[model samples]
Target chain A: MSDRLPGFSTLAVHAGAQPDPTTGARATPIYQTTSFVFNDADHAASLFGLQAFGNIYTRIGNPTNAVLEERVAALEGGTAALAVASGHAAQVVVLQQLLQPGDEFIAARKLYGGSINQFTHAFKSFGWNVVWADPDDIASFERAVTPRTKAIFIESIANPAGSITDIEAISSVARKAGVPLIVDNTLASPYLIRPIDHGADIVVHSLTKFLGGHGNSLGGIIVDAGTFDWSTGGKYPMLSEPRPEYHGIRLQETFGNFAFAIACRVLGLRDLGPALSPFNAFMILTGIETLPLRMQKHCDNARAVAEFLAGHPAVASVSYAGLPSDKYNQLARKYAPKGAGAVFTFSLKGGYDAGVNLVSKLQLFSHLANVGDTRSLVIHPASTTHSQLDDAAKVKSGAGPDVVRLSIGIEDKEDLIADLEQALGA
Target chain B: MNHDAYPDNYIRGILNSVKSIAMVGASPVNVRPSYFAFKYLAQRGYDMIPINPGHVGKELLGKPFVASLRDIGRPVDMIDIFRNSSHIMPVVEEALTLDPLPKVIWMQLGARDDAAAEKAEAAGIKVVMNRCPKIEYGRLSSEISWMGVNSRTLSSKRAPAPTQGMRLSLNRMSVGGGDTAASDRAAKNKSEQS
Candidate 1:
């Protein structure tokens, strides 16, 4: 199944997912076990001490997950990848590898809720801090940086809110700061945008959503653009300095451009225990085979939905970047020229009651917590997901009580709009 | 007709009670916050029903997941919504039509909708904005245990972990979960038992 001069659909179906050599199975098989056996002792030490790259444990690597990692890296235009348990895990692992406690990182304020919580609350426990910056205003990043800052993060297309980050601007800022710029590409899912092509040093994804396409599996990946110079960074001793963990082997010296992925695998995954299951990896791969197709349809459907919601009598406003009048449309065109990703928010005229009524009434759209699925999802942020925050914090996050978010699926445009119309009682 | 009075005052009381929460966006996916929060809250013994229309009949932690709140049949005290903000109106409407309107409408960390909040508040439902129930449970319950030095109160001179003598695991003492109101309950309950 190796691709040969194939299109995205063809490559997605074939790339890195060739027929199983041992079993000759057409579909990817789940390698559901803990440890892999070594042929010999020297081979074992070579593996344990990073002398060779081979699977030691399911936590570090799995053959099934490897296919997914390789395929996503290939699709995302990166040299290598590390598949982890979830997107948040990829972020935490990347930060842990980059920072040595007391370190800071600049991040776009309009990020996914979990990432916001992780940065503000969880990571603080580890002594890692995040300074907020607007991706639209890249200079905010420079102002936030200090001697201890290790990275800058921005979403390729921020979730639920289609805010396209100017990757080139942020990447330059990261380069100036001597740190890698990590981009969360879950919403864009590689078909619509490739972060590395725009100067990103590393890219992360929550395969649970768009990348997995069908919403059946949950996975996350970290891809190395192979651009960051680990040896010269001086900030990351884990890569530049000798590794006591692996018989004092220098990661940067041993694994040239792909050193970051290796670090993520050998140290982060091994310690964090947030490894992706082989079953989930197989499911994600199956889903990605339809990534481009699904994403295009999703974008179209979302744009249509966003338009209808904006124009509807019961609706107050919409936030899709595809809409010319949208605040983010310009950035979307600049960053996501092909199309803005398929998630957006809108307000209802009746406020909270209308929002709640719409969720129960929508016959077509499913009301769920996640986005980027094949079917549309709706949520009232005020009453549900963001309710724990104070009113001030909620305002800062752009989740006011009256707003509703839609993760437009790859469904028929008319059906999506019709559902909204019916839900809105127009 | 003041919309601000929509939720009966004392939002905390509406949210606090013998509870089971059905998280609509709950996933087994580790990358998603819903998975962690669902599992964490479950570990704390809140009956969590993971309702994803995609996996309607399937189970995450072996609990039957009815697709929508409409499918859940009986009333639950709270429906902790994990969905996006734009889509909340329908869920709120469904809750309002429930046999007994849910006591509270809990939005997850990133979720908010003003119209939906106003509607819910107008219906005498308490609205808590941009917060997670799992986090509140952790902070409010004595379960937050002993957070280290940083776990001290944000403003008050008194430390939450009074003794400073005991050690705290990261999970037992977390920063976001320690709302003062919930902590007070945890303390009162503990002292009464003693």
Candidate 2:
């Protein structure tokens, strides 16, 4: 074997996977079963007591999902990872491990509409308060810190707008506050930017997006960077304190660097129970094998489309960091040098009516609520995703009435541009 | 120097070379991580000597407990420290006083002391920090995969058949007897009859 480490593309294909042990089949076979049989009573006891690592039930873990988890963890340079049902499920599992009742977590103001709703509403019920801070202003995050602050959350690339976040700057704030920096890397994916390298303690992803490439599956993952000292200050009891459910084993003390991921799996997934289907894990695994290739094409096509929209007379503004004139261009260059990702938003000169009209006139781009698919997708976020937010909140999230989000696909750039031109003209 | 990562070969070499391990801070309590590790290594055919000054006469899984490294009259191949990070320096100093110094010093998971590690390495001793021997043994032997944990090592070679009182070695090929087609067929036939 060579001393050299495997590259990103190679890891994307081969990490966390081998030929079927029994059948010798090449590709990973979906272990569709729900529970694994124990070797004996001793083996069963060992697994339940956390003395041994093995699958006991599918709700907690599965073989197919384990492969997906390891692949993402390797890609993100994380010590370990956990696969969950959806992007929202990933968020719940992650925060449940850190926050107690009445604890506060700082989150960027510019986030996905669904996330904003979840934080402001569902999380409030659980007494996990969210203090909003502007990603553009580093001081806003530092100012939001309180004695109760347990974590700082931000996205590597803001959804809808595709604006680049200053991860290192926010990470400094988290460090001073003795909190973990959690970055949602859904928009960029590991192919574009690895948040762990930028001081993120934990990275979350909606594998339903570009990682899956195809829009056929819904899955999410949490990657543990293994950087934080969870046992310090006794701030994170779920990790530092003895877990009563697992024979009073201290997760951080036993699992060490990968304890956060384990806590999420054993405590959060075990109780809350949003488990990823084995079939979805299989689909996402196949999708990830081609991530590097697909992501580059998506970026190239997106740049062409953004450029065309910027030149169009009917378009008032474009919010893609790939454009030289975009506000986040410099940060984009520093963080995601590969490309500025493929999902971005543009405003129509005629405002909301024009945005909705263009969506109807478009021939190729599918009108949907989702982003990051193999085919181009279009959505007027104000009337759809961000409709819950009032006028000022909508504009702040880069989802104004005139704003139309586009998730560029790997289709030929010229064909995409031509389709947009006809829709704008019509 | 990066204690967080060790080459697979380096870990494999240490595990294979060491025959007996004196585990500092070994507990009589069955729930403790130290007890779990001691029992596991003992089961894997290693001479596991438990050391605890507080429980000098107590035993874990039939292995007699010693007060400290000095109490072990025989030459120990390795010293597995299960103490806290701050308490490691004294333990390392004690291990160095042994007539024939241990070949390796292994710290339990979450237990790391850079200065102690440097001191041991200066004395020509191999040191592994913030890692669990039981997990490493399971991973290297491809035993962890049976429970769906990613061992992060891939191989195509067939696993050896099980024998009475089976003991898996680190050098064995990858195994997943739990998910094999033969097991699946047996399960299916049993379900059909029921």
Alpha-carbon error at B75 in model 2, in Å? 3.0
How closely does chain A match the true chain A in each prediction, as TM-score? 0.96, 0.99
DockQ (CA atoms), all models = 0.01, 0.15
Query: How do the residues B1-194 of candidate 2 rate in per-residue lDDT, one tens digit apiece?
Result: 55645766677778888999999999887678898888778877889999998987777777888998999999999999998777999999998888899999998876678889999999999999767898788777756544334455555555554332346656632222112122123223332333
Give the lowest summed-lDDT range of ten residues in model 1 chain A. A1-10
RMSD of 2: 8.3
Q: Could you give the C-alpha RMSD of every candidate to the true structure, in order shown?
A: 29.5, 8.3
Clashes of 2: 2
lDDT of 1 at B22: 67
Give lDDT: candidate 2, residue A195. 87
Per-residue lDDT tens digits for candidate 1, residues A138-256, read 77898998998889999989855777778888888887887888999998988898888888888999989988978787889998776676655478998888777775666664444
TM-score of B chain for each model?
A: 0.67, 0.84
Best by lDDT: 2
TM-score of chain B of 2: 0.84
